[model samples]
Target: MESFADLSHFLRSHRLRTAPAETGVSTGAGPRTAPCLLPAELARAAGLDADRYADIEDGRAGRVSLSVLHALASALHLDADDRAELFRLGASPGTSRLRGLGHLTRAVPMLPVIAFNHRYDITGWNLPGQALLAWDLDWPVEHVQPNLARMLFLGRATRALYGNGNAHGQRQVAGLVGALRRAVEQHPDEELTRLVVELAAGSREFAELWARPAEERSDEDDCGVLFRFEHPAVGLMELSRVVLEEGAQNGEWAVVFSPEPGSASAAALDDLLARVSGRPC
Candidate 1:
């Protein structure tokens, strides 16, 4: 796996790799080659002070405004996707009332659903959903919030639970990092920041993937995915997952898994559901 550096390191590295000529800065006559701009020079081009710009990369300057972020993007010559990612990093995780709720779960007819916020915090899981994943929901264990990323990386039974464990684990980790890296950059002050910081410091896998550039991670436009769960009791369960975002923009998403029609996996799922529910009340 390729290990990646944080935004600060990434920005610094890109800046070094870019030539002065590319940004329309002139290099003094040397037969050798044109050089990259120093931090000071680049900052000047961005119309920002060197210290403030450094703070932007490090995420120290709180709540970077749109104008300033755009200026930096323009100065860095970031493309459309890069600009979108940069914007996500700069945006705030709008105030959400996710933590205080007694239960974060939601009910959808004839489907197994789990709810989570943009930060990947697993808020709720339907009984069928729980039967599929088979993990306890005890959260904020000594201040560490229970989220999907933690389970995938730290849980003992997590890998065994997945039919395609190793590959899926890596893919999930990568996707989680891609989602989270932007969040940390966005609201490095909120409760979720604690989760991100702790995971980054504690989990090497999480850290390495989080450092990967956005383009290297999963596509943000992907509507859903296909997953297979190797449940201990049920054997195998395959389903297509679609993330249904609540209209409120509160960052909550309902993850629903739909079993395929006339598939063995679907039959197994039906049997498992019946065994668990025992003739629905």
Candidate 2:
């Protein structure tokens, strides 16, 4: 049950432990003979003052330059997916028009268009969303719980699609629990209260994060989830999820796509999209 802070710490540690060799920097004997580099060493390698970088790593600061994060990721030799995740963790959430639409929800033009309320309940979804979810479009949105966090852990297809299901599920639950805590602080009510209680009751991981006072919220703009899916007919693919907020009701849209061009998965997704749109598979 790692909080976002915990995940940040883990990533920092992982980066430090793997930096020296990857960066091709040798720690000249003496007292600095450790295999891994410290925050200072990492900072030095990335051409920054160690204290400032340490502040960012310790969560004392809200802003982190993307250039710095990228430099660090490159120094650490992170793969494309991990590098993208690092950059995402540093971006700010963009403001949107769909921020205050009350309880009503409507899908935007984003791929896999879906909308949910502050409680993470599904309110609207487009055709592409139904295809991606493998869900029946005829059903009422109210009948389906659209909480992405809940579905990642509870839904068969979603869970199976997330290759590192447990870790990803826990991280999302922690984030949603963190959001719920903020909502409670602003305006306590029956629905928000009930949703919190229900989520706690239903998910052990969510309960654990809820029990702990939430750490500082992550930069919503910088956070992304990676999902790996294997369709019955399309084969295997990986998608990077980008969450965009719509209105004041805390409505969100998640868009998924492959990172690499001309890959089998990309071809498969394009084919699926064509078929779903009544074009061609």
Candidate 3:
């Protein structure tokens, strides 16, 4: 079981980025400080034993106390939002009591929108959404709904959609893997377990990448980031992905792709969508 990997990474990176003076810690004479506190120093500041803090940093700590978390947050001068993220990251895996999604209940026609449940299951997508991502609308109704991780790591269509093994495609795939890692650590569902096992069995890339700790994976946005995809129909196009989350705990995140306006990419999308709309069902 993973234990606060995200929290630890955030802590360590924040520590490194923070200067000694900022934290009211002294830099010893005769040499410039590295601008970060040692694990022992940080532990002392957070009122925890050195070894215990070391365990947390290395992800060996099984669980941590709220007092210690509060102490660390205070010591690090973390803001409310980051403190909340830290707590969420450090939370027990079983704490994910997510609600089931009913409907998307929202739409933005200027962008292609698709929503996913907590399990990262693709629950809903708009008309332009399918064409924008070049999805196969003819997938038989008998099959299970498509998932982002599986579609990215296991499907052959991903290559065509993302540019046939382009660097951008690989990065996008890795980011999705990271997001999946985050979800897996937060919730341990039998369905998710099966998905992981199935992907690991079939996809060497997924298996190898997933083996790495979440902290080591890129913490970049899985969506809502600008990226270029070489669409076979639209040619090279850049899109800004926006992810909007619904509900509180269930938090169904919808990803919206909007072509960058006043650019060739936008024009290409316009032409492509027109052609797609003209096609017969």
| Winning model by lDDT | 3
TM-score for all models, in order of appearance: 0.52, 0.46, 0.56
Give the TM-score ranking, best first: 3, 1, 2
Q: For candidate 1, write residues 2-57 as lDDT tens digits.
A: 11123455567768877776677544466634367677667877889989987766
TM-score for candidate 3, residues paired by index? 0.56
Lowest summed lDDT over 10 consecutive residues: which window, candidate 1? 136-145
lDDT of 3 by residue, 1-281 (tens): 44367657877897777666656654557686465777777777777898998988888786666566667767777643344345445553322111211122222543566656556665555445656654454521112345767776677765567766678877777777777777777766788889889989989988988997665643247445777777777688888886665432453466668886789988987877686665431
Question: lDDT-based ranking, best first?
Answer: 3, 1, 2
Compute the lDDT of residue 241 as modeled in candidate 3: 83
Model 3 C-alpha lDDT versus the unseen true structure: 0.63
Better of 2 and 3 by TM-score: 3
Q: Give every collision pair in model 1.
A: none
TM-score of 2: 0.46
Better of 1 and 2 by TM-score: 1
Cα lDDT computed for each candidate against the true fold: 0.59, 0.53, 0.63
